[model samples]
Target: MRRAWWKEAAVYQIYPRSFCDSNGDGIGDLNGILQKLDYLQELGADVLWLNPVYDSPNVDNGYDIRNYRAILSEFGTMEDFDRLLSEVHRRGMRLVMDLVVNHTSDQHPWFISSRSGRNSPYRDYYIWKDPSPGGGPPNNWGGCFGGPAWSYDAGSGQYYLHLFTPEQPDLNWENPAVREEVYDMMDFWFQKGIDGFRMDVISMISKGGYADGPLRPDGLYGDYTGQCANGPRVHEFLKEMNRRVLSRYDCMTVGENSAVTPELACRYAGFDEGELNMVFHFELVDVDGGETRRWEREHSWKLTDIKRVLTRWQTILDGRAWNTLFWGNHDQPRPVSRFGDDSTEENRVRSAKMLALCLYLMQGTPYIYQGEELGMTNTRFTGIAEINDVQTRNAYWERTERLGVSHEDMMRVVNYISREHARTPMQWTDGANAGFTVGKPWIALNPNYPKINAQRQLGDPDSVYHFYRKLLSVRKKSDTLLYGHYQLLLPDSEEVYTYTRTLGGEQILVVCNFTGKEAAYSLPGGWAGAELLLSNYGNPCSGTALRPFEAFALRHSG
Candidate 1:
């Protein structure tokens, strides 16, 4: 492996809106994040990726940023950002701010100027296409959030593009002027003594000039790939951005390229020539979504299936671009509830440990979301009125009364798909708003907070938090865990997932029971002499009883 700093690091992602609410504002703020830095260092995270904290209208929460240069007053001031940078560095950690340049809030100064009139010089900063001969949008491209992607303005008599909500107007990366402006913003942040970036919706930067997508079987063509993602000029623009802002700094750059495949993974993170340090894939996260375009369908994700897809990515990208391994993020439901049993305590902890073993031992950087260390589960919202995400509300109305589907039928789907499942405030301790705030939170905390907060888990030796800390320590100290060759063991095991990793003649075997049933498994012939390294499951021998959800990691003599 190359000597890149990112290849050997573990990252933690913080969704600031839910992290902690300082000043009792019910919304997490800069000071709240500052208070958690020590815990982050202790958890063995070297990189911290803070999602958008920029001044925003909050139409889409922090993702729809209105200002690139200023931190939202609600979060904190520029001074707090400076303090955050200093605190991260003081702990020997690197901080990576999210770069959401794919689009800007309609309230942005550039957009305000662009939307002022047809003759405005800033009109070119955004994509504006003339009305069709019939005096309507050029094509039938749909917004990623829903409905048509283009929204017209009476003031300008021209249509602006938005792949998501109308408030978020897509920037015309096709224009050199727009690209330069974005590059300047990158320089400004880097100049602020920040480390690097985690680019949001990165693959969507390039567009196909307002073209339509191919028709689908459902009579609605919802495909957004070739029409927007990885467009023809995207890489050229990134390469130029690198030449101007990124190349000048020895900082890391990761991309939130959800639909990214192995073929293009390396191109985004391939050495000095590539555009990013790594790219995130939602392949694992979407496993339970099944064939539903959204997560409204009942689905069962198999252990074999999950292993198959992830292992293939590891094999394909072994020496290519580094893969980003994550089981949960701000957008997805908590992994323990979604992947393991939420009804029992033993099942949850064991599953969390098993999942940590699987991901941290993989071939790329591991990203642990907030509350993941303590094995937090999902939030239960019984009504649409209780939901916070706009997408959820839109989908509920569209799928229920508008489509005449039963409320019960759709709620089943909402139970699985709503982003609110992950948006609830973090459980810090046993108190009001789960110790996240002294007042009401901007969003509700998962009510299971009393049992899952950090204070309770951090001190317990058998807690999932401790297992993850040990996992991080092992990955840090053992070359095998860091850069070892990986081999799948017991590929055909009905109830267990087992694998081995070896580097510099030090070999470690990892095994786990994937279900709530006790599974019996064995090491290959002549492999019994290995010593136990770090383990949670009670035994290591063949036909050994693996209590439901328990996992094992053993170091064997070569």
Candidate 2:
């Protein structure tokens, strides 16, 4: 495999609004992030991926961009951004901003001009279609958050496409002018010493236009995945984007690709294709999903299922393309709560470490979400009033009102899997508001902050925080963990997840007990004298009994 800085880097993702609050205006700002540079550097982070802090109306929590070049006032000024960028480089770390070019805020100047009238030159910058013959939406597709995908404009007497909320209108990538404008905005950032970009929903850009989808049982609107995601011209557009701007700079790019197959991923992320460095595929997270989507209340996921999907991606994309390793992000529930044992304090810490070892030891660049290193679990929200994510709130109302799902049932699902669960203020200290903000936080802090806060973990050498540092330190020193060939061990094991990484003559075996039961594991004969590199249990293994949530990485000597 070709070597790159990003390939050896351990990235930490910060959801700025929830990371910290500097001025105490009940919101996190750029200065708050600036103050935490040492905290990230201490945690062994090489790249920091900050979620969108661009100027926006906050309709979708900064995903709807009003100005690509301006920083959000709530996040601080443009000058603050420059200082923050400089500080990150000073610490020998890099910064990657979230690129949300799939859509623009309706209030953006370009969108405003495009929606003015049919004769406007910018009208083609956005997708607009006349009303259907029945005088409703242009198509039967539904917005991802809820409601019709097409919103009617009274002044223009036409409908504009929005895959998300109506306030976020889809940009017309078919328009050469729009593409040029996007490339120019990217150039503005690249010229400023930014490291790279995490392109949001980038695969949805080059659409062949809209079409009616299959009607669901609710009979309201149809699913848009088949018609909208991974559009026909996605690769073509990405290649053009690469040639125009990305190739000029030594930067890393990863695309958020939904509904993408292994073969399709190779086409979009193959190094020779000049598209992107890697793509974040949703298959592993969606393994527990129901017939409609992942938020369904009735769902069950097997450990084997997780292994199958992840192993397929690892094997298929080994040399053809790259892979991205992640469990939690701004848009998903906390990993420990979703995939590990977060029901009790003891189980939470052990299982958190186990999950970390399972993913970090794999062959990919690991992306750690804020508070993840401290084993922060999910929120204990009881009602919709505490929720901030537009998608979660929309799902609650749709499930309870339209589908006749009981309020209790919906709340149960929301508590377990809502995106808001991941958006709660970071647990920085044990003080009020988890020391995230002196004032009332924009979102309520997670109740378990007293035990899971970073201050407490930082002082304990055996804490998950220290374990994460050790993981990064070990990964940095070992080329096998970074660029070795991966092979799944005990591929069909019911309760244990085991894998091996080998490069040159050295090899490392990672064994993870995914359940709470006492399982038996006999090490391979060849690994008889291997040294213990790291373990969550804080002790060397002496028996065949693999205790609940036990995980360790073993390295073989020459």
Candidate 3:
């Protein structure tokens, strides 16, 4: 496999709204991030992936862009952004901005012009179609959040497609002018010394036909994934993007490709495909999701299923394309609570370290979400009103009001799968607002922050934060961990997950006990005497039985 700087780097994702606050404004801004650079540097982060900070109406948490070149007033001015970028480079860390060009805010100038009239010059800038025969939406496509995907404009007498909420309209990738506009916007950032972009819902930019998707089993509108994700022309557009904008700069790109499979992933981020450097796939994260929607109840996932999904991605994308290893992101629940044990403080720390060892040891670039290193677990909201995520709110109302489900039952699901779990303020200290702000916080802090704050972990040598630092340090020094071939061992074992990476004469084996019970796992042949490089527990292995949530890496040399 070819070598690149991005392949050897660890990306730290910062949700700017919750990272830190400056000026006691109850909101996190660029200056807030500027204050936290030393903290990220201490965590051994090579790249910082900031979530959207562009001017927006906050309809979808800044994903809806009103001005491509301007910074949000709440996030400080463009000068604040420039100084942040300069400081980041001075510290030898790269900064990548969130590029959300798949759609624009309804208040954006382009969308405002497009909605003026059917004959408007900017009408073709967005996807607009006449209503169907009965004067309904252009088709029965459902919005990703909920409701109809098409929103009608009273004055224009046409429906505009918005795969998300109506406040955000999908851009017309079929129009060359629209594509050029997006590329030009990207160039503006690159010229400002920004490293790269984390493309949002990039696969949905190209659509198949306007035909109605298959009717959902339990909803009024049709499914959108069938006709939207990884559409026919997505590659053509990405390739064009690479040829025109990306190839000209020394930058990195990682696309959030929804509904993507290993087969299609090779085309989007193949080593020689000249598209993106890597892509984030949702297969591993969706393991516990329901058949249709992730919010549905009674969906339980097994450890064996998790192993299968991850091993497939590791083996399939070994040399053809790169992989992005992550347990959760801003849109998903916390990793330790979802995949590991978080019921007790001891189990939380051990399992958090185990998850880090399991993922970062594999052949991929590891992405650490904010507060993940401190073993931040999910937050439980008492009522639906406590939730701030639009998607979760829509799901709660749809289930209770439309589907006749009880509020208590829906809140149970909300506690398990709500995106609000990850949006809680970062626990910097045990003080007011978890030290995220001095003023009233826009959202509530996790009550457990008093025990799991970063101030406590930074002082503890055995804390999850230090374990992650050690893991990254180990990964950075070993070529076997970065460019080695991956192979799964004991794939059918439910209690244990084991894998090995080999390059030339060196090999490293990773063992992770997934459950909270003692698991009997004998080391593979010729590996019993291998040197233990790292372990979550302080003691060396003296028996064949593994402790609860125990994880360790062993290195063998011929």
Candidate 4:
């Protein structure tokens, strides 16, 4: 109903650790991101959402914040971060920092004081409870990174709650002091001129009092997602956050909401709610995974299923709420690997372009992860030793040892769904380490970099990188693509995903062939003479059948 700057802007998410290395430290830093500002501007991104670069033990790769006001020593000094912010603004781009407030690193000073004794003032800064009568965790809740959610602290003789790894202790959001501190920390950044935050696991900040949950079939611990995710006080806390700090600033806020539905999403991101500008819901990405158990097994998701998931969000949130459009991120496998065919070079480039045309043309703010525009494919990790993500390691142990699954089978699943797949160093050049770093990479680089690096694609007009640039340019100029109404076409077609966007007197028809073979696609009756605005294959189609992975956007020139 109303227009917002964020709604019209495109966001590019940078996993800083893998973006580039400036000091040859084998890790990406603020200076490295500063060096890439021109590259981002050339790509037509108006917003840059960088992953966490705060002081951390890196137990969960910067999600565990040891200090709210400090930058990681490895990532450079605060002055470097200041210069980064300055340069981003100078180039007419906004910077959105990754805000991790649901938990603090166990090594944080507050956690250190809280674990000192039972009566310490900071003790309530975290959730601490006496162990169950049987001398185990306070409840049967399982940590997302594996094992019990409560870790025993021998000194205090109490257990602390951690929804993720034990190194990341859940913060007590119910405590007024804690909430005040969080808001204060947020203000500290807003004062520093950050455009906004991509709040990590923001929905899990509030918990409905600790309790045992339904046990998994393995009988080790219970799934606490229901009890913890989008907990009772989540909205209350978010609303208070807005009233205190966010509303005062003219900025954007997106929450990492895991277990949210469209109805609930409306409340969190509704324009009038003053909670969040948008929220990243995983329904579209989690299409293959089971409802509660993700990455435990592999699944074959159909094109119709993906269409259903996306169309629902588009139609419902069109005017009521907002959505964040993304296919890959630091926590997801590459889109070409997960949703497209990456078996061959041609297919990789074609499908990558197809997927981009499908999502970028939708009605929402689109986020492009680093290297995604280069048509990067998943890494071929040989063994468990090659992975670095804590979640992936935990899942390996759970599926193989705890669930009695075979090692080969578990590795197969990891190969397909591991977050490590997305953490590979950015492939800049087809040189050593994909030109990401002169020293050893902090993580492995996808071997396909030689064939899919940016150096090879930047000059090629038909490359995925250029295609994405064209898409962003088109979106910038076309009101219909940015704010138009979305209507699903051929909703039940398994081979073709089609949609139309209309605004005022303009209408654009989009058709995507979602398969490895040529798909029989026909114009939607009266749209036969529509003017072709975009396409993956060279020029407009000569016939109705689209080539393998072919995609097109047609504007009805009526």
| Tens digits of lDDT, candidate 3, 1-558 | 788999999999999999899978888888999998999999999999999999999988998899989999999999999999999999999999999988999999999999988888999999988888887876778888888888889998888999999999999999999999999999999999989999999999999886453344536435778888889899999999999999999999999998888888999999889899999999888888732557677667888899889989998998899999999899999999988989999899999999999999999999999999999999889898898888888888887888888988888888888888999999999988899999988888899999999999999999999999999999999999999999988988899999999999999999999989899977878887788878999743568889999999999988
Local accuracy by lDDT, each model? 0.81, 0.89, 0.90, 0.89
Q: Which stretches of model 2 miss by more than 4 angstroms?
A: 209-221, 290-292
Tell me the lDDT of candidate 3.
Answer: 0.90
Q: Tell me each candidate's TM-score.
A: 0.96, 0.98, 0.98, 0.97
Clash totals in order: 4, 0, 0, 0
Model 1 Cα RMSD, Å? 1.9
Which predicted model would earn the best lDDT? 3
Model 2, global lDDT = 0.89
Which lDDT tens digits does candidate 1 get at residues 3-94? 66777788888999899887898889999999999999998999999989999998888778899999999899999999999989999999
Off by over 4 Å in 4: 211-221
Query: What does candidate 4 score on TM?
Result: 0.97
